[model samples]
Target: MTLQQWCFSYRGRLSRRDFWIWQGVWLVAMVMLFTLAGNNWLDTQMAAFCVVCLLWPASAVMVKRLHDRNKKGWWALLVILAWMLLAGNWTMFNGTWQWALGRFVPTLIFVMMLLDLGVFTGTAGENRFGSEARPVNYFGKPNYQ
Candidate 1:
């Protein structure tokens, strides 16, 4: 798939390599934006912009990666759920252990998702998603089988 389609649309399988590359690029862009914008209102605005502009592409990448794993796109929502849990700042219990539990649970989910999506190989060939993941050269050209 083309770069535009890869980032904007969500209808294909993506190899782990492409998922890693695109995710790394997106993270770098987010870090640069936040760093350059500084810790002020502009930073908040930039963060908002990143949410609106950058987040969807990241989601698309993850969705495609999930597809490659022969999983439903809904699996990608785990990342968001983990993030939300981590940010929840649970105070349900007065005990400090509650915080630890909350953090640990989400962190565990994150680790599991990371391993499933990044470490494990995708389904050997297309199962239900689409064609096999075409290997790409350094310059992004398809390396046909």
Candidate 2:
């Protein structure tokens, strides 16, 4: 798996090791972007732009991680939907108890999905999405196997 394929493509599986490794990289990239931006409006905008630029790679990595679980790419949407529900309804958290359950459900969903994607190991072998991906080395050289 080359860096390009690992980051940009959605055709294969991502092992638990690669998923965590790339996730760490993603976290660092986000922190660096935001840190470099500081509090300047223009810089913040650029930092946000960089974050948006990472969206696809982030999505691809997550989707591939899901695929490794022997699940469909559509399963990835559950995470997105859960996140949207939680984030989109933040104001309602203080609105009323009636809306409390609404927030709780999505929060549960998000946490469950996070556990599923990040903690559990993928299926042992090839699945419908494709075979396991070879680990790529972005630090020194690209592994194309």
Candidate 3:
């Protein structure tokens, strides 16, 4: 997808290929943000802004990823709630081990969930979430019967 389309496109389900492409883009953006900002107050602020900017696309990707697993996108909302709790500790209160634990533990769980979703192929044929993501094609063209 084009950059603008990637930014704006949130409807329908995303295939595993789409999710990986978005992830690669996100990783590149993050690396650039860190390399440009370095260890400075500006870096801190920019990091926060970057996170805000990425939140929607990230959420959309996660939702679609879950959809690929035949789960409702609402489950991603719970992931957000967990993230808020984690971020709150870092932002509102001084960084504490408790806060780190709060963030890291739940995040580990979430990562595991993502691994499960990505590693296992979805059900063949249409599901409640959407049509089965075109047959693992590299180009993402739907293989018609």
Candidate 4:
């Protein structure tokens, strides 16, 4: 598949390299966006629009990467939720409950999710989420079957 397809599709497996590359790209884009915000090149509305545009592609890539590990893409949703609660300090429970569980539990879940996605290797070949994606060449040709 093309780089665009791999980066955007939610129905395929992605190699670790491709996953990291897209993540790096996302990081750089975020930094650039923040820089734009700093310089007033992107106003609040523009920043919000840009963030919305990035959300799906980021989620798509995360889902594909989860597929690579032979897990359902829905796990990506859990990851996001866990992250939001953990890092964003969002809690529906009372402050006491938050005080008890918030400090350690959410952080643990968040780190485990990161290790699951960022450290684990993909299934050797394929199990369910279609066959492994063959690496494409510079010319956009598949390098292998």
Candidate 5:
């Protein structure tokens, strides 16, 4: 699939390897943004802009990744919701109700989702999402067989 379709549409399956690579791309982009913008309102604004622009792509990727596991794409929404709810508040819990409401619960959910998306292998062969994503060998070349 094209990069636009792979990262910005939710119409197909994505293998774990592809999903992992996509995450890596975003990680590098985030590091670059942070390093370039540094500690300032510009940094925050830039981050927000990046997130807004990438949100659809991020959702599309997660949906496709979930499809590779034979699950509904809407599950991606739950993950996004969890992040939206918990990603604020830099201060780690300090004996406030926010500890339970923000830190603890979201951490548990995040760990679970991480395992679900990043650890487990996708279902083999065709599924409801689509035909299996074309498999790539160790060198990232397509395996013809």
Candidate 6:
């Protein structure tokens, strides 16, 4: 799939193959950014920005991951809102314990969500979210067939 198509196809299922491919792309991009940016402070900041840009695809992959488990993409909205609240609190308080709490708690929640995604398998056959991601063989039957 094209990167844009893969990123936007949140309504359907994702195969493990697709998920790993996107993750590899994310990791390679991040490594290249860090290696090329070097030690310059300005370059480091620019690389941070580039990392955020690269995270779009990663986030999209995560969304599809959630979808594979039959969860709604709206779950990502909660994650984003929690992050925004934490960031806002941190900015207002300037790194106090309260700020740390604001940031840390949401991060914990987000991490838990990711852990849940990792362990949960999608429903077999067609779920409300989409078709089974397991591939069909050349005989035009499911591999399990």
What is the per-residue lDDT of model 5 for residues 1-145, given as tens digits with 9 covering 90 to 100? 6666787778888888888888898888878777766866456787779867877777787888889889998777777666766876746656676677677777777788778988998888899878987532335445455
- Extract clashing residue pairs from model 2: none
Off by over 4 Å in 4: 86-96, 99-106, 136-145
Task: Quickly count the clashes in candidate 3.
Answer: 0
Q: Best by TM-score, which number?
A: 1
Q: What would the TM-scores of all predictions be?
A: 0.84, 0.80, 0.67, 0.80, 0.78, 0.64
Candidate 4 Cα lDDT to native: 0.76
lDDT, residue 86, candidate 2: 61
RMSD of each: 2.8, 3.0, 5.0, 3.0, 4.2, 5.4
- Give the count of colliding residue pairs in each prediction: 0, 0, 0, 0, 0, 0
Candidates in order have lDDT scores of 0.80, 0.79, 0.68, 0.76, 0.76, 0.67
User: For model 6, what is the alpha-carbon lDDT of residue 84?
Assistant: 73
Residue 59's lDDT in candidate 5: 77
Per-residue lDDT of 137 in model 6: 28
How big is the positional error of residue 112 in model 5, measured in Å on the Cα after superposition? 1.3
List the pairs of residues colliding in candidate 1.
none
Q: Candidates 1 and 5: which is better by TM-score? A: 1
Tens digit per residue, CA lDDT, model 4, 25-126: 888988988899889988967877887898888888788888889999888777566656666553777888786465666677767877888889888886
Predicted structure 3, TM vs. truth: 0.67
Q: Which stretches of candidate 3 lie over 4 Å from their true place?
A: 1-7, 39-47, 88-104, 134-145
TM match of model 6 to true structure: 0.64
Evaluation by lDDT, superior candidate among 1 and 5: 1
Rate residue 42 of model 2 by lDDT: 44
Flag regions of model 5 displaced more than 4 Å. Answer: 39-44, 87-97, 135-145
**lDDT at residue 37 of model 4 (Cα atoms):** 89
What lDDT does candidate 2 reach at residue 137?
A: 60
